[model samples]
Target: MGHLKDMVGANVAELVVVRHGETTWNATDRLQGQAESDLTEEGVKQAQAVASRLAKTAKHISAVYSSDLRRASETARIIADAIGCPNVTEMESLRERHLGNLQGLARAEAHLVEPEAFKASISSDPDESIPGGGESLNQLHLRSKHALENIARNHLGQRVVVISHGAVLRALYVHAKGCQPAGRVRNTSINVFRISASNDWSLSLWGDVNHLQGTNLLRASQRGDEMR
Candidate 1:
């Protein structure tokens, strides 16, 4: 709910978290969940643009990590290559929230099939889970916390880039800000956070896509289900 900068000591690690670029599912307004989707052509260009921006702004990034999902991994690879980071460690914990029966469904279809379940899936309750074996918002928050803490501990005082999904990042953002995001996270948007030596987290930036300006790559969709 509060900025970590106000709560942490000087010893801190900087984390640059990025949402993956657009995919076919993103363009089609479908839920992707843990299912895989390749980056669209525009998505590739977006990744390149973000990589260029990060290369100039975060040249000191010590490591790159990404969700194992194709979209996230592909984005991470581009950024890693541009920054000369050489490797991108894939972490399953960074993947988007498992959508269960909602995976691959169109937004309209999901809501029509089970309006209550669809509503709960998009609610802010940390314990709310998608029906049919999906992870809860609380589960997502915990995994994000663990993944970030592990990175901070292992790469103390360093800057690292983490490529993840919108839903996952949204959960982390909620954990940091103690509220739901004001809007959807754009493709290749960067969020900056700091983890103190005591493991406190603070958000420095959120949903930043300054590099995408004039690129016309940002989507206008408000479908929450598309974030998976």
Candidate 2:
């Protein structure tokens, strides 16, 4: 771990949050939810690009944490190698929101099959659950917040990187910023947050994909299973 306690004072921690690279589901416009998918070739490049960017930009990254999902873990591994970090701590709490029956459906198919359920799943209602089995947005918020709080507390005065899914990242963004994120989170995009000694959080960056410029891997349809 690379501690920056001396440089950053003992009370503050900077958390760098990254969404995993695109998976085959993402390319095909399918919902992955808790279901798993392998990263596409472009996804691998995106991960590598972001990893290189972080290695060049971040002064000190004490730890790397990732959702245990294969997509996220793979991205974290690439980044860990780029940053010379030895290991990544995997946390199930950081996984994507479970979409239940909507897990593998394409967006259009989901709407066609169960419009009402789809609407509810995408709605802002924190308590609304997707049909079948899965977590509500409110439930997601709680777990995401709890996971982030724990990480911040444990790594105070250090810089840590967290690799997670889109929905989970949105939940955390709303928790920190008190507003829905402005747009879709691109694959391997970086979001920066500052955690005060008291654990109060502030967002400094969100959905930044400048590192992916010229990669030609950006997706056209922002609508996806995990995001909706």
Candidate 3:
């Protein structure tokens, strides 16, 4: 793919992790864990920005993977087109954390309505499950871990891009950086990591949203250099 020509080699696979472009729910601050939503006009532009920037990585990405969710799928399509990748592969393993009962609730509403429950659910031990049919943080960690390992093993030396939901990325980052999973990930943020030749993974950058530096699409909720 055009976005990955510079990343193929015999040493390690450079992994480019990007959150999907914005959706209506995203703008509304709606919780969309495992919920399917389409990209908004702003999201299309955001994905284009990512493609414009990543097209320069020159890493020969051997493969492209995206969550089956519509927003992620659409965002992946834009990147694939920019990089000339023949296809975008859909992988269910990359879906967002199942928020279950919290699926459609607004963030503020959830917090104000159930502060204690929300706090408990997002504590240090992500294993705590949410109300309704949501999955425990542990489950999220396990699925994402399995998916990442599989990708590393199957495409050891090839660079790849994964378009996933915010929660899925958070789980991955928490595991990679040994941090607590809470808060939000910026829209269209790019995180870079690599599967080393020694069979270890290292995160190079987290939540880089520089591509939106001069764009008018910066979310109203974001401030300064942060993509909140």
Best by TM-score: 2
Q: What is candidate 3's CA lDDT for residue 121?
A: 57
Segments in model 2 whose C-alpha atoms lie over 4 Å from true places: 1-6, 219-225
- Ranking the candidates on lDDT from highest down gives 2, 1, 3
Per-residue lDDT tens digits for candidate 1, residues 1-228, read 122232223388888899888888887888888989888888898899889888887746889999999999999999999999999999999988887778888876988886766877878686888887788878888998888888888877678899998887887787678877877778898898888788877898998887877656755222233534
Which stretches in model 3 have alpha-carbon errors above 4 Å? Answer: 1-11, 111-120, 181-184, 220-228
Clashing pairs in 2: 31-225
Residue-wise C-alpha lDDT for candidate 2, range 162-219, written one tens digit per residue? 9998988898889889988877877888888878778788987888887776647655
Q: Cα lDDT for residue 50, model 3?
A: 84
Can you give the lDDT of residue 109 in candidate 2? 91
C-alpha RMSD values across all candidates: 4.0, 3.0, 3.7
Candidate 1 TM-score, true structure as reference: 0.90
Superior candidate under lDDT, 1 versus 2: 2
- Please provide TM-scores, in order, for all candidate models, with all chains considered together: 0.90, 0.92, 0.85
lDDT of 3 by residue, 32-74 (tens): 7777777889889989988878877545666789989898899
Q: CA lDDT, every prediction?
A: 0.81, 0.84, 0.74
* Residue 8 C-alpha lDDT in model 3: 53
lDDT of the structure predicted as candidate 3 = 0.74
